[model samples]
Structures are given as C-alpha cells and as structure tokens.
Target: MHLPEIDRYGRGHSPLHRLDPRLKLPALGVFLLATNLTWKLPLAALFLLVAFLLTLLSRLPTNFVLWHLRAPAALGLILAFLLAIFTPGAPLVGPVTREGANLAATVFFKILASFLYFISMVATAPLFRTIQAARALGAPEKLLALFLFTYRYLFALLDRARNLSLAMQARGFREKTDRRTYELKARLYALLFLRAYEETERVLLAMYARGFSNPRVTLPQPLTSAQVLRGLPLLSLALLLLALNFFW
Candidate 1:
C-alpha cells in the first residue's frame, strides 16, 4: 500500500520548519481568530500579506500551496457571486449592491488568510508531531486517540481502494454512466467497509493481547529559551493583529 507523502517540504532547513509545534499551534489559532474578526479591507489585506510571507518562509512549493487553494478559491467565487446578486443594499454598479460586494470581498480575503495560515501551521509539520502538540495543548484524550488512529489508517484505506480499482480494471471493468457502473461502485464500497471492519478488529485484539491499557503518549522535549525567542515573532504578529482588530 503506497501512501502519498505529507509535509514533503517539512524536512527542509528553514527556520519556520524547525520551530516547535507546541508554540506554532497556539499562534496559528490566534492568527486565524484575528483575521476572522476584521472586516476592514486594509486590515484584511495586511493579514493576507502576512499569511503569504509566512508561507514563503516555510519554504513550501508555490505550486503546492496554489493547488490546495483551488477549492477555497472556487468557493469564494461562488460566495461573491451570490452576494453580488442577492444581498440587500444600494446598488454599487449594475445590479450588484455595495453592502454585498463589500461583504463578499471580506469573506474572500478571510478565506485566503485562514487557508495560508493552515498550510504554514499544520501542513509544514509532520502529522505525528502535530498530534503531539495537540495532546500537549490539553486536547481530550479520547479525541486525540481517535485523530491519531484515523490519520494512521487513512492512507492504508486509500491504498486498499486503489488496489481494488486496479484489479477491477485488469479484469476488464470500465466505468460507464449507467446503473451497472453504479452497482459495481456500491459493491466496491461494501467490500472496503467489510475489510476495514476486519482489520480494525484484528488491531484491537492485538492491542489487547499486548496489554495496551492507558496508552501513554510522550511529550516533546521541554521548550528552551532560545526556542521561545525564535517563536516570538509569530506570537508578536498574532498579538499585534489582535490588538489592531480591537483597537484600530
């Protein structure tokens, strides 16, 4: 089962990549909150610039970030279009109302800002380390465990589905826009579910046999003064944005 790589750029020597996740996670939350709280165009644009700079600093590929943004961009366009046609306010140009246009622009910038922050904060870290940070931040134990297990098995499930599709193709199965194709896809889903259930049962039994009671997740090394110093720029940026949101 081949899994698609995550955080491909995370192994780089960039300082942002090396920053501790425990600090990064909280700063990300604050940044997201600050961006969402503001409707001012200039402030939103400032947040967008900050997000772009952070992404560049992380050293992730430009194509990777843009590719991941397509969905959000599409959704933003749809929202803007809806607002232009449906919002109640004085007309700005043509049939578009001033209030709706303003609202749409705000939503678009907010989405862009939040998406870039997510890429910088979450996509730049190894999955396990992110989970560790979540646990350190006092995430509920059951929720953490569930998240860990889901992430661990997600690729395996994708691999299984890919293999099944390949086998079907080798046996001369070709999809058509018809009932037969729908039925075949339905059966494939059922097969995947049954396989997943059996695999989960086996794993649970193995864990029980190994006496895996109260699984303990170890915390990362204690944050040093230097690490805190290195992370101050991000924390300060978030604080500044929060201040601007409230006082500006």
Candidate 2:
C-alpha cells in the first residue's frame, strides 16, 4: 500500500526525525506525564510551546499539524461545555460557575498539550519505528503486534469501505433522513465486517503457510553518546515541568 502524505513526512531529514526512536519515545512519555500533572496555566503554556518547537524541528507542514489538531480541539470544546454545565459550583457568568470555568479551561489546555505532544512524537518517526521503539521499551509483544496489525490494516479497510460507498453511489444510492438510509447503512456495515473477516482469515493462512508461528524478536539499535546528549534537552524540560508541578 502507498504511504499516506501524513506518514510520508516522517522520512524528512530533520533533527527530530533523525533522533533515535527509543530516545524520542521515552522523552515523549515523560513529556506527556509532565503535561498531565501540570495544573498551572503558565506551565501548561510552556509545555505547549515545547510541543510547537518540536513540531517545527520535525519539519512537518504547519497546515498539516493544525489540521491534525482539529479533532482534539473539537473534543476539548465539547468537554469544556460539559464541565461548565455539569460541574457544581456558584455561578460566575450565566450557567457557568467560576470553578467550573477554571476546571474546563484546565482540561482543555491539558488535552491540547497532550494532542500536540502526540502529534510531534508520532510525526517524527514512521509508524513501524514507533512500534519497534515501544517494544524496545518493554511494551508487551502481543499488544505491540496488535497495534502493528491495526495500524497496517486500518488504511486498507478504509479504502475498501470508500470503494463500496462509491459503488453504491454509482448505483444511484441516495442517502436520506429516513429508515431506508439507516437500513442501507446497517447492511453496508455488515458487509464491510464480513469482508474484513475474510481478509483476516486469508492473511492468517498466508502467515501460517510461511511458518510464521512466532513473532520475530529483534533488539533496537543502541543509542550513541551523541544521540543521548541530543535528547537531554527534552528530558531536562520534562524534569523542569515536574519540578514546577511539585514546588509551585
């Protein structure tokens, strides 16, 4: 299968792209941990700034990064609305209380910071490399294998579904706000599931035929001194955040 444009950007010759995936992966973990633990807005803003710098260092398209953030931004807004309406506190403005607004704002910034951190981490390396790095960091092999398979097949499944939708459209299938549309969608979903099951069976058979009974194990490449040094800045930033969380 052809690589998606979003995935293709990871192959760029940038500092972040060049960092060892093992180093990057753990650094991302610490960064995320620090971000989640931070409650103060100033600290969260710092984390966001770090995420932005990392994005720039990765040399990914700015528009692509912004587009990628849209889902998280939408979800954050929804969460803020729910918190403002549901959280119990004395009213500050309209239905929203001061405490509720503060909590919602905190959650929104936290989610935004996390989304940016993830995009920076994932965009800096190919998917397979990220999986491998997770394995190297002692993630369960079975879990990693599941992640690998899902990532590998998600696009293919989407393509199959798209083709099916296009074929239906060509056959004059017009969706409407009615029972017929719902029934057609249900049938389409069932057919997609069946096709996916059959494809999975074929893949398993092919794997068995090739004597692939066990998952192959390979050690991740060791990080060099220079690579470790290069990663120290991220680590230091995470530590600084953690220190602030504890002391501030």
Candidate 3:
C-alpha cells in the first residue's frame, strides 16, 4: 500500500497508535468476546458508546469509521430481521415478537458493535504493526511470514496493474478507437496475469534461496510501560461495559 494512504487510515500519532500493537489486538479480541458473549442490547449500546468515544480520542474521521461500519451493519440488520421474524417472540415493531426478538436483537447488535470497534482499531493501527503484534501474541512463524508477503505483494500487484492500464490508455486504447478495444483489453489483462504469475514465482524462488522456509526467530518491537498504561484504560472500558451489562 502507498504509505500515505496507509498512514491516513492505518496509522497516526495518537494514544491508540502509540499503544503496542500486540496489546491493542488482544484488547480488541476481549472487547469482541464481551460484546458477543453477553449478547445484550444494553451491553452492545455501552460498547458502541465507548467505541464512539475512542474514535474521537484516536482523531479518526467519523465518516471514515462509518464507511467501514456500514457493511457489517447492513448484514447484521438483515440477519436480525430474519431471526426476529422466525424465532418465537413477543411482537416488537411491525409483526415481530419480543421473546425471541430480544435474543436476535442482542446477537445482531453485538456483531455490529464488534465490527465497528475492530474497524476503529484498524483505522488507527498500521497493518504491519498489527501483524507484528500478532506475531508477538504467538502467531505461528509460517503464518506471520505469509501474512507479510501477502500484504506487500497484494498492493504491489495492484500497482503493476494500474501502471499497465495507464500505459494501455496512453497507447490509444479507448472506446472511441477504431481497433477492437475489448479484444485489446482482454489480451492486455491476460498478459498482465502471465507477468504477475512469473513475478510471483521469482519472489518465491528468492525467498527459498534466502531460506525463508527454515524456522527463524525475529524480535518484535519492545512495548513500553507508558504504552501499556495508555492501553489499560481502553481495556478497562471494555470491562466496565461488561460490568454495566449485569446491572442492566
């Protein structure tokens, strides 16, 4: 990915960004656990409130956060309506009943809450750092390596395709052109696919030459006490939401 795009969405100078990636990830996992396990509307509301507050603290745009949240929210909404309709329950809004309705509402809201929180975490934390954090949290060496390579090369391949497209356009590849643009575009795409495959093979060979398959140990960045101290409040908020669920 371009550094600027990643920096805008994935990393920034904020309390959330400064926290060790490893800690933030696990804290996120725990947040999801509490949200889903409790599966209560009140608990979900509390989690969303805290998540909203964190977005402010992290200095990410609300619109950007909403963009990521929309997809999961849409799916959750569909599932919730289906469950509420089918599950035996007292009538809620419309024809839906309340008995099993509450359970469906709880599950749906929990999923939405968890998705939004995770998206916020991603927006404020660099993907690379998150992967490193996962490694520190004991992700398998092979998986971690695969993650890194995939991350790097995925964007690299996209960049190459974009460049190729530009070159084609510059060479008069357009709808108005007399030549068959569709045929040309297909051949261009096929060539790109071949090139991409060849490039991938070269990369794999280079990795093999470097003994990437062999077990190797590498140190992740050290976490500072100050970083943990900052993250502690976020974790506390997650727990506090769980606690509040009991009173509700």
Candidate 4:
C-alpha cells in the first residue's frame, strides 16, 4: 500500500490495530449491523458518534477516514434530495416533507456510521488477517476469492491505464474533441482490454501449472484474554444499542 494508492491509509499499529482479527471482525460486524438496523434517529446519531470515537481510537490519520467518506457523503446527499422531494408527508418546506426529511436523516446517519466503522476496521487492521478472519468465521470461499481477486485487479487495471496514458504522451498524442481523437481513444481502450485479457490468461495458466492455492495463512489460534477485553467495549455497545432499539 503506497501513497496515492487506494487502501494506502489501511496500515497502522494502534491498540485497536493490534487486537486479534478474530475478535475485531465480529465486534465491528456487530456494530455495523446494529448501526444499520436501528431506526430511531437518536439511536442512529448515537451510533454515528460511537463509530467516530472508535475511528479516533484506531489512530489512523484523520485523512484516512475522511478520504473514504467523500463518495458516501455524496450518495447520502443524493438520497436526501430525492427522498425529501418525493416522499409524501406533512409539508415541511418547498417539496420537502417532515417525514421525508426524517427518513433521509436516518439513512444519512446510518451510511456515515457504517463508513466510519469500516474505516476503523480497514485502516488499522491488516488485509490478509481480515480475510482470514472472514474465512475462519465460515464466509464462503468463492465469495472471498472473488473479493480478493477484484481488489487485486483494481491496482492492475489502474496501472494498465496509467501505462497507456504515459505511452500516448511519449508519442506526442493530444486529446481533441474530434472524431480522430475519439477513434484513437477507443483504440487505446481496446488495446488495454486485450492486454488485461492476455494478462489474466497468463496468470490463470501459471496458476494451473503451479497448482495455485490461497496464500498460506495461519490465523492466531488462541483468543487471548487481552484481545477479548479490547473487543468487549464495542461488542457490548453494539448489543446495548440493539437492545435499546428492539426492547427499550
């Protein structure tokens, strides 16, 4: 994970970072599940507050979490706009209703809380350990494999695109809003696609030739008392929130 790369912010060694992935994964999972499931705005807000605090505890730079938040914030705004306009209720403002605004706020809080919790998990924890944790928890191997490969190929495709752009620049190519430019850009894209396919095929063949398997990984065997203690605060809070939502 290098700077300017996606997931570059995904490395750190705070206490949360050092917690066993086995314990960490479920605790975050519980928090995420509870945050999304709660319907009350206050509860949702509380969940968001809690997640933000936990993100701070993760000790990754603030930019690490904020950087991942841009897309989700944009999405929440779009949903707010659409829902506040379309969902019918007592009129609150021009086209927006009180009920619609409330619903949108609920969604917004949930989305932001979920994103922060994910950042806390991903920014601090090692990627391989997280995958292994998922595996140990009985996640389907096929889905995990698909996710792993897709994440890896994002870098591959980006590198491929970057190389093509560099090659074009080296050859004195310049963009113009013309048919010639469109045709050349299309050809460049086609070449990149062909290259990707060729690369994939070569990798697949090499895998078959060498008997490819998942990278050898050994998850920590014993969940330590310290790990349990570290995980409990979040897990307990998640359970309490769920109970508040359902039973209070």
The whole-model lDDT of each prediction reads 0.86, 0.82, 0.74, 0.79
Candidate 1 overall lDDT versus native: 0.86
**What TM-score would each prediction reach against the true structure?**
0.90, 0.87, 0.74, 0.83
Q: What local lDDT does model 4 show for residue 220?
A: 48
lDDT of 1 by residue, 49-143 (tens): 99999998888888888888888899988988897778899999988999888888888888999999988888788877877888889987778
Give residue 38's lDDT in candidate 1 (0 to 100).
Answer: 96
| lDDT, ranked from best to worst | 1, 2, 4, 3
- lDDT by residue for model 4 over 1-248, one digit each (tens)? 22254446556677778776777778778888888788788888998998888888888777756777889999998997898888899999999999999988988999999988887876676676788788878787777778888777877788878888889889999999999899989999899889899999998989878988764434446676877887787677767876777864
* Model 1 misplaced regions, further than 4 Å: 1-6, 171-178
The prediction achieving the highest TM-score against the true structure is: 1
TM-score, cand. 4: 0.83
Candidate 4 clash pair list: none
Model 3 misplaced regions, further than 4 Å: 1-7, 159-196, 206-218, 243-248
Give the better candidate number (1 or 2) by TM-score: 1
